[model samples]
Target chain A: MKIFYELGRYWIFLAGMFTRPENFSIYRKQVMLEMDAIGINSVGIVSLVSIFMGAVITLQTAYNLINPLVPLWAVGLVVRDSIIIEFSPTIIMLVLAGKVGSSIASEIGTMRVTEQIDALEIMGINSTSYLVIPKMLAAIFITPFIVLISMFVGIAGGWVVGELTGVVPSLDYITGLQSEFLPFNVFFAMVKTVVFAFIITTVSSYHGYYTSGGALEVGKSSTRAVVFSSILILIFDYILTQLILI
Target chain B: MIQVQNISKGFYGKLVLKNVTNTFEEGKVNLIIGGSGSGKTVLMKCMVGLYEVDEGAIEYDGRDFSAMTKLERKSIRREIGMLFQGSALFDSMTVEENVMFPLTMLSKMDEEEKRDRANFCLQRVNLDNANNLFPAEISGGMKKRVAIARAIAMKPKYLFCDEPNSGLDPKTSIVIDELIKEITYEFQMTTVINTHDMNSVLMMGDNIIFIYKGEKFWSGSSKDILNSGNEQLENFVFASKVMQDLRRHLKN
Candidate 1:
């Protein structure tokens, strides 16, 4: 019953976020700033993690394919499929669920505790729309691009490891990457990225906006935002995979 | 004038305000004074539409605030500006941007006009040569002044302040209180202030409402307070012995 009540409140919060903005130009400016924060600032960590994960996937696949019956090019195929289908979208989002989610929650929660949100409310601003919508839009607009970057970097990492470690010849790895590549997989990953972006922004915002108490409660809300976003990402990953792939 | 008639508010089955009624006069500082947890903040928030009253009517001039639609409320909201206890300046924005925020969002004024208006308000609050500095870089008194600048930037017909002097030094608190009073009269705004600062009440309070234990305990101007014959009011107004002695000295 408590969970249901909270879920109901969360939906209400999201509904509040969809109200007409006071000024489109101001909102556009806000969206650009949020894009910088949510997308541009996150590029470094996303690329770094993606490269390492791709290298690990390549080496792991090569080690497991000890039988001569499995072709060396198959290593590239496995790495490409794993990175595109799962690692890029899901793992990168999980990282963002920690990185971006905590920041959003803490920032807004601090505002709430300090009466900044109250000031917005008293000024008759649709505080939810003014504060959260830009963030959500920026994330939706940028996370797919980030995931695409992650996929490219991850595949590049696989090629570099293949060349250096001789797990598979670089030429064969490139061939395997081009072999049987399904365009739908990229589309599927994008859909997941968009959904995960919504989850991270809205869920973290809900936790933040409703926060009461002082610094301690703000800290608690930040933790909850990251935890809940990561959990929801995994849950939606399964649901999306079953619906889209199966 | 702003009128709150029989307003009540509750949270989780615990009532914070109970059947409180008061009329806040325009062009003057109307102070609501109460101890901590006395529901003054909640009452002010309700009047500002930040919190919905569980019961009763809030009227600005003649329009029923509680009965209006959200779209209808925007017009009145444009006419209202509030200074928060923590100043509530946007941390991400500079003092100029913070003051210009309402105009930027709600008005069709071009950049030059907005910047000029922001500078005027900042100057009005005696904040100059600090437009580019972020909120974090300013002092507490500057933040409060910047908040006042922001609150009045819209030339609002109604102004609300929540504990505007809570964390400030006595000198700074007095400066803020005077600034609010000056703005209230200058704009003829129906200003409602929630404060427990006795100095603020004595300094600029034109009308005073006292809330005690979620109820309207007393109502009078600052001049009448010393002779109100209300023990609860007395205890609250002179909580410390030094204040009590000062009150006695003033009377003598």
Candidate 2:
């Protein structure tokens, strides 16, 4: 019950924060930082994962679609549908909740444990705006790019698998992707990434913001952040997909 | 210049601070002394808006804090400073960065000017060359000093300290206490401190407010503390055999 109330309060605060012009400067800095940490810095790992995911997803789609009598072109539809509706946004957020969510929880948890949050309140700096807004904005700005990269890589992985396994001809695979992939689907994935970004960033921050006790509590908050926000993201993702894509 | 009136706080239906009313005056070390879990920290937090009061209002020079809008409260908070029990300095920032934080966040000063002000504060706290060190590198005393410097960097009108001597040794505690006293006098800041250390109560408690089981049981000056005559106050002061012997000897 306390957590629910806090969740509501934090969102209201975050929403109200964006109304201030000073928050724009904070948002800009946060976006750049997020790009560096979430997009540029995490690119290698995300890309590597996407590459493998792409190959595996494509292979699986092909295997499921393969019928001796069925045309191979339909495999592209399966891959496209999965990537657009489920794989890219949801999986990327899962990975990020571990990496980025934990960072938010730990960083803010340490701040809470240290009384830095109190220090900020004393200094008249809205600690939430000062600390959370930047991270949230950065996540909102950067996650779409990350998902974009992941989608490309995941799809590319499928292409590679299709080529090597001799299950489908390269031209057919390329043509299948070209024909099956819709522009709206990519756009939808980007939009979903934005929502996922907001959820992970805000939930992780909320977990850390109200932390109490000492180093032990900070550790617990950080772990809880990753575990809980990841679950929240999946739940929200279902609602979003039903509302938006279905 | 801080007034807390009939403030009550409860957690999960358990009352922590009940009908607590006190005033922290300007240019004084107004100490709130109590045993562990006596709600001194909660009272401080209520006065500072960290915890919402269930029944009453905290006023800054008679201005109702609870009635103010969030923005108004934030603006008023700019005039306040705090030294936390944990000396909660930012770990990633260096000492200079930690000191300059209030300035960076609130002041219109440029980076060069902010750096100069931060250095001045560090110097005032006797941390002149330690600006580049991290919080982890500083001694416990140094961290408290740094926390003090950070608190005063803004020249806040009100300063709230929660167990400022909690983790420090006796000698260091005295030093920190003296520093707080000096700063309080120098700036004429209305300072409120929550503490349990008897030495601090004797050495620097110009005005003392004693809480007993979530209520303000006694309020008096340190000078008159020995003769409060309240049974609870007597029990608290003479709890230890050495203190009991000293009280008896002093009475003679």
Candidate 3:
């Protein structure tokens, strides 16, 4: 019953955020700012994690395939598909759920505790739309691009590791990357990235918007934002895969 | 003028404002005074439409505010400005941007006009040479003054302030109180302030309401306060030794 109550409130919060903005130009400017904060600021961590994860995936895949009959190009196939299908979209989002999710929550939670949200409301502004919509739109607009970067960087990392460790020849690895490549796989990854982006921004925003206490409560809301967003991302990852892949 | 009529508000089945009724007049400093958790804040919030009353209605210059829709309220809200306890300036914005925020969001004024209005407001608050500085870079008194400038930036008809002197030195508190009083008369705004500051009440409270444990206990001008014969009001108003001595000195 409590969960149902929270779910209902969450839907209402989302509904409130979709109302017509008081000023379109101000909102447009805010959207640009949010894009910088949510997307541009995140490139470094996303790239670093993607590169390392890709290298590890390649090495592990090479060691697993020991059969004499199996072609070495299969290692490249595994690296490319694994990175594109799961690691880049799902795992990278989980990492961002910690970095970006907590940030959105804490910033908003601080605003809530300090009466800044009240100040907005009293000024006849739609606080929910003004604060959250830009963040949601920015995440939806930019996460796919982030995932695309992760896919390219991850593949490149795998190629570098393969060449340096002698796991597979460059020619065979390239062949494997091109083997049985499905365009639908990229589309599927993009679809999941968009959905996960919504979840992370909205869920974290909900936690922060309803925050009622001081600094201690703000910290707790940040933790909840990350935890809940990560959990939802994993859940949706499974759901999207089942619906799209199966 | 703002009229709160028989409004009651509750939280989790416990009433925070019990049948609170009052009229805050225009062109005067109307102060709401009470001890901590006495529901003064709740009463002010309810008047401003931040909290819905469980019973009764709030009217702004005879318009039923409590019955209005959210869309219908925006026009009234645009005519209202508020100063919060924490000043509540946007942390990311500079002082000039903070004061210009309302005009930027709601008015058709061009950038030059907006900057002019912001600078005029900042100057009115006696805050000069600090346009580019962020809220974090200012002192407590300067922050409150900046908040006042922002509050008046829209040239609002009604002003609500919640504990404007909560964390200030006595000198700064007196300065804020005088600023609020001057603005109220100059703008002809129906200003409502919530505070327990005795100096503010005695100095600028043209109209005052005393709330005790979620009930309106007394209402009068500051001059009538020492002889109001309300025990709870006396206890709260004279809680400090300085106030009590001042009361004694006044009686003599």
Candidate 4:
């Protein structure tokens, strides 16, 4: 019953955010601020994680394909497919679920407890639209770009590591990366990234917006937002993979 | 003028404000005074449409505010300004930006005009030098004053302040009370303040409503409050020993 109640309330929240913004100029500025926070600020950490993941995947795949019968370029093919289909979209987003998700929840929860949300409402602003919609828009507009950067960096890291570690030669790895690459896999990954982005922003925002009490409750809401967003990302990753690949 | 007609509100099956009916007059500082958890804040929230009343209508001028659509309510809300207990200034914004927020969001004023209006409001609140400071950087009294400046920046018809002096020194509280009264008169605005500060009530309450346990216990002017002789009202108004001593002195 509580789950149903939350679900209904979540849908209503989404509905509330869909209204026309009272001022497009203010919303546009808000979107830019959020985009900077959600996208640009995240690049360093995402890149750091993605590069390491790429190197590990390359080394692991090369070690496993010890059979001389498997072409050396298979290392590249494996790394490319793994990063595109799973690592870039799923792992990076899961990392963001912890990073960006917690920030959104804590920021909004503070506002809720301090009556800032109430202040906005009294100013004739649709508080939900003013606060959450810009965040959602920022994530939707920017997360895919982040994923694309992660994919490129991950593949480049794999290439660099393979050549340096003698896991696979650069030419063979590059050949394998180019061989049998399915464009649809990239499309599938992008679809997952967008969906996960929506989940991260909205789920965190929801937890924060309704938060009551003081600092302790804001901490709890932040933890809940990260946990819920991570769980949803994993759930949707499986669902999207089955729907798209199967 | 704002009229609340028998409004009632509850939260989670607990009735917090019950059949509270009153009028907050224009061009005066109308005050709602009560003890902690007396539901004065809830009543103010209902008047501002932050909390929907469980029963009865709130009228702003002649329009039935409670019955209006969300779109219609926006029109009413635009004419309303509020100072929250915690000040509620945007943490990310500077004082200048906070005061200018309504003008930036609700009006098509140019950058220069918005800045000018923000400067004027800040100056009015005696916060001219703190424009670039964020809410966190300022002291509590400055934050309250900044919130008041923001509240009045839109030139609202109604000003609602919830506990504007909660954490202030007596001197700052009096300053805030006098500032609110001056703004109310200067703009001919209906100002409704919810406070437990008896000093504020004595200073700026042109009209006063006392709530006890979610009910409207009494209503009268500031002058009448001294001699009203209502037990509950006296207990609340003269709760402090200083006030009680003053009352006895005055009676003698």
Best by TM-score: 3
Candidate 2 differs from the real structure by a C-alpha RMSD in angstroms, to one decimal, of: 2.7
Q: Model 3 over residues B1-252: C-alpha lDDT tens digits?
A: 999999999999999999988999999899999999999999999988899889999999999999998878999999999999999999999999999999998899999999999999999999999999999999999999999999999999999999999999999999999999999999899999999988899999999999999999999999999899999999999988988999999999
lDDT tens digits by residue: candidate 1, B1-252: 998999999999999999999999988889999999999988988888878889999999889999888778988999998888889999999999999999998888999999999999999999999999999999999999999999998889988888889889999998888889888888788888999888898888899999999999999999999899999999999889988898889989
Model 1, A92-114: lDDT tens per residue?
99999999999999999999998
The single-chain TM-score for chain B of candidate 2 is 0.97
On lDDT, the candidate that comes out on top is: 3
Write the number of the candidate with greater lDDT, choosing between 1 and 4. Answer: 4
B-chain TM-scores per prediction: 0.98, 0.97, 0.99, 0.98
Q: Which runs of model 2 end up more than 4 angstroms from their true locations?
A: A1-7, A10-16, A19-27, A73-81, A213-220, B248-252
DockQ winner between 1 and 4, please give it: 4
Write down the lDDT of every candidate, Cα atoms only: 0.92, 0.83, 0.94, 0.93
Q: Which candidate is the best by DockQ?
A: 4
Residues B35-73 of candidate 2: C-alpha lDDT, one tens digit per residue = 889899888887888777899889998899977876788
| Cα error of candidate 1 at position B98, Å | 0.1
Which residue pairs clash within candidate 4? none
* iRMS, all models: 0.9, 2.0, 0.6, 0.7
- lDDT at position B119, candidate 3: 97
- Candidate 2's displacement at residue A88, Å, is 1.6
Native contacts present in each candidate (fraction): 0.88, 0.70, 0.88, 0.95
Candidate number that wins on lDDT, 2 or 3: 3
Docking class of 2: medium
Candidate 2 or 1, higher DockQ: 1
A90-206: candidate 2 lDDT, tens digit per residue? 997889989989888989988988778877776667777777777777888878888888888887788788888987677877777777457887787788788888888888887
